[model samples]
Target: MKEERRRHKRLDLDVKIELEKLDEGGVTTVKYIKADVSDLSRSGMGFKSNYKLDVGTFYDTQIQIWTKEVIDAVIEIVRCEEKENNIYQYGACFVGMTETDTLKIDIYQLFNEE
Candidate 1:
């Protein structure tokens, strides 16, 4: 079997995130620290986390402050890696991304480039 490799588009950002798992019941949630967003794309993002996320695990992600301005989307863990410092790296893909969300990301990157 061949290992599935990732082709990534990277942007370095020091953004900290409160990664959360919103329950289906809408009454409970689990919070985790997402150290930074390493690489981001319209489809997904790569972040460093203290906990390991099993490959194929799904979640509802909220981008901390951007919550009110954007719609929440479901994401799936495509890869999880353990680093030397005990940090787990996660590569997740958006499961149901909207075009508006993609535009928002593009706009953010545009401003970032300026």
Candidate 2:
């Protein structure tokens, strides 16, 4: 059996996340692909995208919560596995998020899950 390795409880979520790829040397790229989040937690989020993303790469992102609030965050890709039809499943962990941003996330989580 496969062992569960998740550190926190996650909610099944479907939301559109805004993403910007960050170059290792701080070069900005114009390549942007739309992605839809599959799940969310305090520590991480998972999404499916048609574009490929390398694991361990950090990205500047904006997640809109409940269609009313938007928070800026940075996330590192923890895992990426190919799905059917050229889709990729990307798992990312939150990084460098502020305390106020976390509280915003908590409020969004509590209200949206029901």
* Model number with the top lDDT: 2
Determine the C-alpha RMSD for candidate 1 after optimal superposition of all C-alphas. Answer: 4.3
lDDT of 2 by residue, 7-60 (tens): 877777778876788887977576666889998778888999998998988788
Number of the top candidate by TM-score? 2
| lDDT tens per residue, model 1, 1-114 | 976465534445555665566455653366654656676666788888877777876677665323336546677788888998889888888886678887777766676677
- The count of backbone overlaps in candidate 2 is 0
How many clashes in candidate 1? 0
Candidate 2 collision pairs = none
Off by over 4 Å in 1: 1-8, 22-35, 64-71
Positional deviation of residue 24's Cα in model 2 after best superposition, in angstroms: 2.1
